[model samples]
Structures are given as C-alpha cells and as structure tokens.
Target: MNKELITDITKYQEFYPPNSLKAINNVLKWKNSEEELQGTIEALTFIVNQTLMKIIPEGRIVFCTMLERLDGRFVLLDEIQGVLNLNNNQMGKNIDELKNMG
Candidate 1:
C-alpha cells in the first residue's frame, strides 16, 4: 500500500535566533507504517506540551541557612537578620544613620 503522509504543524515558541521562523513552529508528519505514528504522536505531544507550559517558574523564596561558626565570629549575622526581618524600614533608617556617624 502506498501510504499518504499527513502532517500537523504547531505554533510554538522556542529559544532561537531573532530571525528564525523555526523557533515558533514544529512539523509533525506521519509516514510509512502505523507503528511510526506512535513515535510521531509522542514527539508532537511533547513539543506541544512544552510550548504550553510556563517558561518562568513560580515559587516562594526558601530561607534556610546556618550562619554560626564554632568560634562564634559571624554569629551576629543571624541576630541582625532577625531584627531586620522584623522591621526592615526602621532598621534600614537606623543603618543609614549608623553609616553617616562614621
């Protein structure tokens, strides 16, 4: 049987050169046997889903760090962060004043 090749192209943006039309398009063509269609569908599905997904991640900032040394030299850093975290505006003003004093 002479098989007819059918195709489905999609509109999808990808990282490419500014003048590249291939950046926003993917070509999926069905050819030969039915077995090959599975691979084509999977490829097309992946490309379509990837293009639809949010490129930029949405997440909360995780603050988890230990700042204490065995000798206790940088122990004040955590304490200062705690105070500044509680009142940043007031602490920022106080820090400015302290800097001007020197």
Candidate 2:
C-alpha cells in the first residue's frame, strides 16, 4: 500500500484517532480475498500492536475494530514493506528509540 492510500484513510479521522486511522487505512486499501484478508489482518494487527507496545509507555491501541470497519490483512504486510522501503533516517532512529525503551 502507498502512503497516499494511508493518508486517504486519514480523511476518516471522525471515526478513529488520526494515527490509528492512518495505520488501518494503510493496510485496508490493498485488495485480498476473505480468507487471506482475515489472516493478513491478524498478522498485521499483531505487528502494529507489538510496535506500539514496544514504544508506548502504557495503555492500549486497538486495531481490530478499526480494521473490521475497513478491509485488509496483506494490506498490512504491504504497508509494512512500504515502510521498509522508506529512505528516511528518522524512521530508523525512531525504531532505535523503541528498542532502547524496551
């Protein structure tokens, strides 16, 4: 999925917090079959949940409800790959910060 697609979902901020909405939308824009969608959603949700769990000080950031409202799983995988493709140094630094926090 493209960042634009994720940003497109950000338009729905009325439905979810802007950051969570962007993350969910980033994953949902990808087209996938129902069975694949379910598993992909599960895995992607776990990745996002884990990342947040690593970085955040406390509380929870739920994705399943927002994901159910849209459509995706591999979309999450694709979005993550998209993140990996990013060249921004700050992204790596942020990840380092998370690792250090953990």
Candidate 3:
C-alpha cells in the first residue's frame, strides 16, 4: 500500500531509509519521483565538488558525462577536461602519452 496523497506523487519513504543514498529501483521511475531524486543530485554534487577537485590537480584528466534518455539510449552530455597542458584538439583518439613519449 502506498502512503502517497496523490497517485503519481510517490513518497520515497517506502524505498529509501532516512539519509539513504542508494537508488535501487527508484531510477526506473526517476522522472516521476518528487523529492528523492533531488537528494541524490545534491549528494552527487557534493561528491564532485568535494572529492574530484582534490584529485584533478594531480594529473591530466579527460572524462565523458552521459545522460540516459527515457527510451534507454545514452546521449553524450559533455566532455570534462582537467588541467591538460597541451593546446591540441585530440578528441575521440586514445593517445597513450607515456608510450608516445618513450
């Protein structure tokens, strides 16, 4: 039995415990969720802001951000570059800088 006041408004208490970060099956109906997704977003933002900032300065980093659409296809969101000292456009090529240098 759902404890929700409205049919589409799902209260996440059924799925998540207090302060829980686990998504479980909640991701399937992610867009329909009212509040829990916001909490997860905040948690992700906190992680990116707090932890990634510390690690990025240690090396040249390239990463991709992707979004999964409702039709189950993933779309490229953006490419993240962290402190790459080169001024060359090398997209979509896997260049092993260490091997190339040696």
By TM-score, the best candidate is: 3
Q: TM-scores of the models, in the given order? A: 0.23, 0.26, 0.31
Residue-level lDDT of model 1, residues 1-102, one tens digit each, is 111111111224353323322323334332334445545556666785675332211100111112211255555667645543544455445444433543
**What C-alpha lDDT values do all the predictions have?**
0.35, 0.41, 0.36
Candidate 3: list runs displaced more than 4 Å.
1-27, 30-32, 56-58, 61-102
Tens-digit lDDT track of model 2 for 1-102: 222222222223332212233345458775555665567666767776666434321111112222433464445667544444444464545344444543
Better of 1 and 3 by TM-score: 3
What is the descending lDDT order? Answer: 2, 3, 1
Model 1 segments more than 4 A misplaced: 1-31, 55-102
Residue 5 lDDT (model 3): 14
lDDT of 3 by residue, 1-102 (tens): 121211221222133323543465365644535476557767777876675444321132222111111267544443223223324344212233322332
Q: What lDDT is reached at residue 95 by model 1?
A: 40
**Candidate No. with top lDDT:** 2
